[model samples]
Target: MAAPTADSASPADSTDPTNPADPTRPVLDCRGVWKTFGKGRDRTPVLRGIDLAVHEHEVVVLIGASGSGKSTLLRCVNLLERVDDGTIHLDGDDITDPRVNADAVRQRIGIVFQAFNLFPHLTVLDNITLAPRRVHRRARAEAEQAALDLLDRVGLAGKAREYPDRLSGGQQQRAAIVRALVNSPRLMLFDEVTSALDPELVGEVLALVSDLKGDGMTMVIATHEMGFARRVADRVCFLDRGVILEQGRPEQVLDNPAEPRTRQFLQRLLDTEPA
Candidate 1:
């Protein structure tokens, strides 16, 4: 497959030149996003003053130690977690606005988690079809076909009839990804998708993600997979203490980190890698 092109559409243009019929704008745009837990004066801020933009077909990877708010940031993008302040825009519409429909906004953005959230009772095929049929009001046959195609895209078509318990960790995770893709999301949010997998199994999920990158899927991934981030991300963002410490091209941030904290984190990660 050919690599997906960057979003050539301007902010003022409502129609995406890359995907004209898709209503979602710019993939994702956020400004001054903040998430704090607890009451005033005792609140713990998970994300503070985050401003980010992701264009169509771009892959931006968020890298940081646990508790750095990477996952919280992803949740904010999809409105899974409400922001105490700031704004989030998806496909050019303000999702953070009170008038915007949250369910409608979610259709344009799909999220996959570290744990495979597959339904145990349902076959992989059913797992992928449920949302489209129920939420999008798609016909059963149409949804099934879409699910099958997504499963094939994620290399899980052969296991579509199998239950979640019958699959390996990597296979289950891939199924979860297919479920997200079946919704035709313009932007995908991956929150530590490989963190729960066994060491050997991580490659399969990463390979699937790499393939998606090749196909030009717009995505924001929060992960600790340094190699994957370096290879697949168009931009790498380092987050610490609820703020983006640094962000730039992968080569600049991963190989030639400018911040002292980023350097220290990378050093520790590299040191822990097996010889």
Candidate 2:
């Protein structure tokens, strides 16, 4: 079967086409993106032509069932997985270009996964400052001070000297988030960040994300927490069969979805839970 067709209409600029290269454009833009795994006859397309634009300070959430291509889409955006076709523009630069330095592009975007992946022996402060001090060439004192400030903001200042194992699951997750933020990324991508947490711990990690949103951070998140998504996402996109079936304001997409597939998916998700 053929992949889904690319739709270049951006929710932020479906009307304006004058200065397509405007400097103050969307922080992340994926045009006609396609990704596949496996080889030859066994090849399976995960992201079948996803075109999306995430404006500055906007919170865009990707929603779908398992294997619906939500994680693949985010991976392609982060360049963790290469696209089979199409262009990805990060702040007006074609980051998908073969000539582009992947490491350089990655430095500008922060991504967090379901796993904390923090170093076991490193103190919380060390975990957060490692990249900035080593990769960006910041002085040790400067990086440590900045890391402390971020930890304080998340109410983990007292635990900065503690190792990842010493902190609660929620604290570890929040520390991971702060580690990402220390790089001062232009965009942030999250893939089921709270999925591994205990139910009670989920809210602590989520609260830090809420604080980031309030501070005008540009983020693209994939999550199963529909209630949090509804509250924090400026827009929510429903994916199906490797395509974005529908996207709009959270209220519209989550409450009055026009796509039957999306409605069915949401219904099944809600039904699985007592809510």
Candidate 3:
């Protein structure tokens, strides 16, 4: 995995379509990001001075405790939550700028949350095709064809016609991932995707995500599954109290953490894991 490097350089030219991950830049860049909620003295800082860069095809996994700000960081990247400070760049474009079109930028990002959030009335195919049809103006046949191909890729070809209610929790989550992929996004974000699934069902969703990484997808994932994180991540970031306390290769960070906070955190997680 390519590690993020800090840069004090000015923004690249807009006319230049140079790849952000082309050794000189990262595909997803979050520079000095800070996010907070509430007002005045009651303010709560969720993310503090976060500077992360994800190069093309790199998988960066964030591991932390419940209040560590992992979800908030992902939300900030997708522009679902506005950042209180700093800049977020996607493929060299400053996505956090108020002038940037939010919908247009979202077309290039695929995010899957803990919830499936599939439309109960829609078939799996419809759920997957909704964004392409309504937002991208893709014709019905074209969108359905793409959705079918994605479903097949995830071993859910036969479930395309099935309603969300008819599928198992794992199946529903997989469909949700497919829905996010219908736009063919350049960046994928997963926010504890398997947290809501039964242990037996969690493997299927995690397997699909691992396969996505094999396909060279650049992704930023927040997961409690330490095993899954070790298997998929090129780099691991451990957050503590809204800040990245330690980050390194999975072997170094997950196995032999340099920071005491990280070591204690990983030890607690290990204690909870079944024998």
Candidate 4:
């Protein structure tokens, strides 16, 4: 896979011609995007103005303290949380437009949450197959086969018949990842995926992600695992106060940080002993 070329288009343009030529047109692009919460007069801006681009087969990690809009930014990429301003493009197609089919867009971009959202009533195999069978109109046999293959890729093939509750936190998270990957999405969004795991189980989940990174899966992860960010991310972005404070290569941003806020955040994160 190739790297994405820089694009300079206004939010209004529906098409991004540069994308096709580049071959690495970002799988996700958010430009000057904003999001607000609350009703009418008391609305609070959660994402002020976020500008981010994620290329094909690249892993971009977003780091920030609580309420820094890191999660919101990831949500906006998939339109789970709509932006109040600016534009979001997926595969060079504008998704911010009201006329776009959000469900279709979502199918191309899979998201894994901190809380594994697997259905308790369903077995791991069913949990992974349900979406493809329903949304893509795939035959049950076909979906099941794909799900099994994905489960194997995630090292959870033997647990196909197990329920979510029957699995450990790490196992459950890996199942969630397999569920998302079964769709063969062009981009993957991970919002603090390891935050809910037990300390003893975090390493297992991170190892799965590291393996995915090695496979050149395009991913945007919001996390506090500086070590994972340093190791897997092609680029690291430090977000603060609903804005990106600084962004660069992991070595530059995590080790030789230029921004005071980034340096402070790293210091605080490093103060804690490794889990």
Please provide TM-scores, in order, for all candidate models, with all chains considered together: 0.89, 0.93, 0.92, 0.91
Which residue pairs collide, candidate 3? none
lDDT of 3 by residue, 1-106 (tens): 1223322222332223235445657788787688999999999999887878787888999999998999999999999999998788888898989999999998
> Per-residue CA lDDT of candidate 1, range 1-275, in tens?
11122323223233432454655446677767889988979989998888677888989999999999999999888888888887777765778887878888888888999998899999999899999989989999999898888788777889999999999999999999988888888999999999999999999999999898998999999999999999999999899998888888899899899999999999999999898
Clash count, one per candidate: 3, 0, 0, 0
Which residue pairs overlap in candidate 1's backbone? 24-91, 25-91, 25-92
lDDT of each: 0.85, 0.87, 0.87, 0.85
List candidate 4 segments past 4 Å from native. 1-19, 22-24
How much RMSD separates candidate 1 from the native structure? 5.8
- Candidate 3, run of 10 with poorest lDDT: 1-10
Q: Which has the greatest TM-score?
A: 2
Per-residue alpha-carbon lDDT of model 4 for 141-257, expressed as tens digits? 999999988788778989999989999999999999999988889998999999998889999899999898888899999998888899999888899988878888899889898
Residue 25, model 1: Cα distance from true site in angstroms: 7.5
lDDT of 2 by residue, 103-174 (tens): 899899999889889998899999999999889999999999999998998999999999999998899999
TM-score of 2: 0.93
